[model samples]
Target: MKTIGQPPFYSSFFLATVIIALFLGISSFVTYQQTPWKAPASADAKKNPLASDAATIAAGKEVYVKECQSCHGKKGKGDGPSAATLDIPAGNFSTAATQGQSDGALFWKIEEGRKPMPSFKKKLTENQAWQTVVFIRTLK
Candidate 1:
């Protein structure tokens, strides 16, 4: 038995555990605060998204085939091989709700590129990006 002046072995162990728990809790809170959470693209998206004309869609397809296919897939399904190694998974482009997102939103995403996705603003002209938006409208 240890005197009150000196902590017992179990007291030291308990103190150490409490210190570790405190450190981990603080670290977790810091990490959570540092991570940015992006809100969904549309707060109130249209019930029926705009449908681009065939001519525009065709122009957009050309741009997509040239610029986006390698990562987004030939069919815009986000299953391209390059997508596998990407930090952020490529978006699936076939669903109506997804493809239905506004042209402005799509253009911004293409221009800005999310995290692991590199921005194409410097690589492709804005017109090309808008055309890609048009092509996206045609996907199922």
Candidate 2:
């Protein structure tokens, strides 16, 4: 027979497990929400070889359409279909915060993506990544 005052052993264990899981889940969410996705100072210093060139910008548009449009939207508004499903919101490139960043900083971000954003360091050639930064600059 079980005692009236005390909970069963399995029930207590299950409650404890649930509490711990909840704590971890909340902690992770808070941490992820608080962290900023900033490139290193070294990365910020790295310049784009093809900065603002018309042809490079055009090439970058093609790459953005093929690779980034799904997550960043057709106009870089961060309102893509998949944006609804992400834990972190997709960046709005048209915003001043994004536009204000240096080309190198933007390039570094594209090369080394954060969670929910795939890194293009391996997937895209250096030229292509730099070109993408050029295309992003045109988003208004």
Candidate 3:
């Protein structure tokens, strides 16, 4: 038996609620799209690690040529062939301003490249990444 004030089993109210929920979802999505992306804490500049030797640098350089030169440039000056067409732009390793990065910071950046650049964490070994960090510090 139905109650005195109860409506029928089918109702327009259900449809309205779904529509409102979808609209709110889309609005939230649009707002999210407008927000800018921030770098991860690992990318922080303060924790940069330094490399200690010529051998490490040389090893890093070899890795760079094989893995990074496409975007980071031959000397890390960010003049590589692909650098010109990148939407976000590549890093300039040759400049002193760029060289000011800490070793750990550089290592972090290489391990997890910013957007557009792929992460080498899986492709390259941790040691290889550190070697590359050593090479990057020499880019003056």
Q: Compared with the true structure, what per-residue lDDT tens digits does model 2 show for residues 1-140?
A: 66898877999999999999999999998976858777788887888898588888899999999999888998999988788888888989999889988888999989888888999999999999989989999997
- Candidate numbers, best lDDT first, in rank order: 2, 3, 1
Q: What TM-score would each prediction reach against the true structure?
A: 0.62, 0.81, 0.62
TM-score-better candidate, 1 vs 2: 2
Error of 3 at 29 (Å): 18
Model 1 lDDT tens row, 69-111: 8788988888777888775557678876566666677777788
Error of 3 at 94 (Å): 2.5
Candidate 3 weakest lDDT stretch, 10 residues: 32-41
Instruction: Judge candidate 2 at residue 115 and give its lDDT.
Output: 81
After superposition, the stretches of candidate 3 with alpha carbons farther than 4 Å from their true spots are 1-51
Ranking by TM-score: 2, 3, 1
Give all candidates' CA lDDT scores: 0.73, 0.89, 0.74
> Of the candidates numbered 2 and 3, which has the greater lDDT value?
2
What lDDT, from 0 to 1, does candidate 2 have? Answer: 0.89
